[model samples]
Target: MESQHSSTTTARAARAPLVFVLAAAVCAAALGWTYWAFVQTTTGQFADESAWQEAGVAAPDTQLPFLRFLDTLPTISVVIAAAAILFVAVRRHRYGAAAIAVAVIVASNLTTQLLKNVVFDRPDRGVATLDFNSLPSGHTTLAASAAAAVFIIMTPRWRPFAAAVGGAYSVLAGVATYINLWHRPADVVAALLVVGIWTLIGGLIIMRTGNRWNDWQGFGTGWASSRGWLGLCWALGPGSLVLSAVLYFSVQAIGPAPVPGTATLPLFFWWGLAWIVGVGFTLSAAAGWLFADQARRTSARAVVP
Candidate 1:
């Protein structure tokens, strides 16, 4: 029976990385679709415009001060956060976690810049807008990567809370960028996707390294369970989608009229921002739960006499 259990655990452990990889692929494809739809399609351009105007309105009244703070949240601050997380992992002797954390941060940030500057070109999609590309906001990417670093280093037990707090912070940062007109919703979403890909890569590395400290106690009935975050993600993900759809169709019913800066823009802008926050937080929470669960299972196996 012990031998059978060991084999089962090992098999499950082996499958986790594959699951993460497949999920990563889906996120990448989603990001591509987002680009093609919003960047290339006419309707997408309108939606982008709406989102931008909405952000501008919100920036001055509600989000400006917050945006300024986030804007001033320097690259060094992100580095310090990553370093602190890395230090915790190293102190716990989780070298694999430390390395993966750094990789996720460095690789995700570099890829965001590369895509914005070099690898991907934003053609004139006929939208009357800024000339430069801004599909992935660097500020949002930095915030999200720092969050990912935190999620990567934490043990399974702490991940649910981390998921809630870190995911919220990242989502807030992304939304602030939109409100401040730093980037569009697609830009923020793309940054989340980029961080997500590196997160999967980092997960794969952690699984391979087989760090014992990564494990956690099994789930319980409480709200803090690994299952709790997963459930919250499910709720938030679908709920946000439904709300966004409602907003989109309701605005569409009004028809594009009056003027550019008045009616549809603000409505569509909020709609796009809603989707961005939903997608960003849902993905982060789900990924956090995935790692936490995997760690719990692996740790459980490791402790068996």
Candidate 2:
């Protein structure tokens, strides 16, 4: 009995740090995003200008209809998405997972509201944009929170595919906001960080509450266990970062005159979008791996004498 207890303790200890790491990652990303948006003048201008440029690019008559539909995507869509995810969890008889999904959605959206409305003030940082508080976009938060909730309720075997689909949904939503000129890239990034933090908490809760339902079958030949989705994100994430860095320096080398509202902003805007998407995918892949690892440990423990 003592040995069994010790083994369980060891497993818990091992899993705790992964949770801590994910939580810490959210904090770090949030801070870094803030500093980039508010402090770094050049970077801020690039993102701001690029956003307007992206809007210009999407302003064509041909794309306006689709863009308009995406822009008008009501809050009810978020509610419906969350309800659908909750139904999946409840149907699986994973009540804890359902609760965690709800908590993550609520907490993440609340955090975005708090930051946008009360906590953070947009001081006159001498950037070439309106002096309004736009950090942690509400729309991006809505989309990312829904996606994170879906990821939490899925079983380990299905998580990889869910992570891929969910991450894509989130990235598309964020980019759509950008195309419509609703938010800056930093706003999207901040929202992603907020959702990531809440998702980590939800994942921990699910790990403890429904280990049997989330058992990690060994990585066999199937696409789910093969982890092809994770592998794609892992490669794309770093590759996108490298591409963004290269674009940043190349643009800097040209030293385009700080002409406010120039057509050149589109270049940086697309680059910023890519960077934020990479960040989202990277976090999704990491979270998926962490959950699978925890479930695997639980499965091993169950089989032991």
Candidate 3:
């Protein structure tokens, strides 16, 4: 009886994170598909082309100076991620997790950039307004990097949860770029696809190597305290995503989206509903509450370490 009970407890503990990662994947695919083609599929609307064309708006390439500056985000994200892996190496002294994190982050980021320029580069309508491989987005790629990096070392079950949180942030990143006019609706969709495909590849690698997923363990707040990190994430993470989506879609519905600085803002509105209400807050809140509820019962059943 004692051995059986211990085995059950161990199994449950390992299952949690995998659940989160899976959940994230579902939410990402659903939401991503919606923004990328929800209305169009149902109503035959091609806003990316129609919205601007009817209004005589023309899409333009990223400006040289700004493009040069913004192009550094991928690099910055990579550097920060490298340091994160280094910290894990020096502190935990775990080569497995450190190596996986470093390798996945670098490979995924580089692959996305290369695909962006090589496979996706094209001039539509005598200009680079659109490209074929642009279906997956790099902004979302970075977002995935930030989120997936955490999960790659964790148990398989935790992915859904990470995806839940990570996917929201990924969507938020896409929206922010869209707001800043850095990418089009299609670009955002492409970003999500890119991240999903690469991250899935990474997950498969982990699975093949037999590394289990880890629970968030939740980061510390800016005060450098674990509790502080939880508090900050609890307060700002959801809220920030909500605010960012609200603003993005609100602007989207109001104007001629797919065009910069003067389109609709309805998309932000849908974004809020999908993320804050659908996944981020509503679903996430319920998930967190349930996880906490389960955690207590779980703790009573087994030793953590």
Candidate 4:
């Protein structure tokens, strides 16, 4: 009986699929981001071939090198790298996990930058032709890669919160990239693609790690259970964003929409989108809370019978 129980636990752990999921996350993030960028910039450049101008969203102007540098910092990645190393050292007691994580992280950076150049396609000096390869963004790859690294270490109980935090960090990377370079805003969104894919992938990979993040779900951890999962997303992520977007446009139609060289409240309206979405950052985790609560009640009823 003891051996059987141990084996069951081992099987559950194996299902986490950490490395495989990491690779999957990388593929999703990279491919999705590349698609988005190509559509936004490459397609535009292709049309005007000579303009070398891509029809994508340009980043807002800013002058904060220090902040930009901070945003680009690989702090989260470093921490994750450490955690992965520590886990292997303690549990597996092998130096390989950490080594692989570090190598992947470093290699991902190179591949990411290479892809960025290819997709964004800036031309040589005195060239009037449009460049092709800048579709998949490099900075985005970096940001996403970092997020992926972090997600691998996160517990499911921490998944929602960790993902949100990861999103915020990726945003920081975007800000830094934007301030330093006028790279397409679409390019920055590569970070979003990277992080989202990994979070989803890594979430599934290590779901059991956070089987019970707490005695009970706490702040940021969503209501437990399948229903809670859907409800959390509806209440926060998509639903809230939809609400904010509607409100933004409604205000614009009702009042004066900020036009170019105008008041720029519309930009604030845009930022409002971010604020509303942030709710999902926490509420999504709180989603799991409902599931646990329901299960407990069911177990209680069964016992009473």
lDDT of 3 by residue, 112-225 (tens): 677566654433342214334343456656865765566455432343354355545655565455444555555555445445444555544443334222233333333332
Compared with the true structure, what per-residue lDDT tens digits does model 2 show for residues 1-305? 88877666555544565665656576667656664664355556555655555565645453466476566655644775667676876576667777778888899899899878887776665556667778787887888888888888887888888788778777777777766777777777788888888888778877766645766676667876568888877776767777776766666677644653465445565567677778778877777777777777777766566
Q: Give the C-alpha miss distance for residue 256 in model 4, angstroms.
A: 17
- Top model by lDDT, which number? 1
In model 3, which runs have C-alpha deviations exceeding 4 angstroms? Answer: 1-14, 35-45, 48-69, 103-133, 150-176, 179-182, 189-300
> Which window of ten consecutive residues has the lowest lDDT sum in model 2?
256-265
Candidate 4 residue-wise lDDT, 193-279, digit = tens: 544444444344333343332122323434421244444444555555566456545544555322321333334324333432433
lDDT score for residue 148 of model 2 = 84
Q: By the TM-score metric, which is better: model 1 or model 4?
A: 1
Report the Cα lDDT for residue 263, model 4: 36
- Report each candidate's C-alpha RMSD, comma-separated, in the order given: 3.1, 2.9, 7.7, 8.6
Off by over 4 Å in 4: 2-62, 65-67, 70-80, 83-107, 117-132, 179-182, 195-305
The stretch of ten residues in a row with the least summed lDDT in candidate 1 is 256-265
Q: Is candidate 2 or candidate 4 better by lDDT?
A: 2
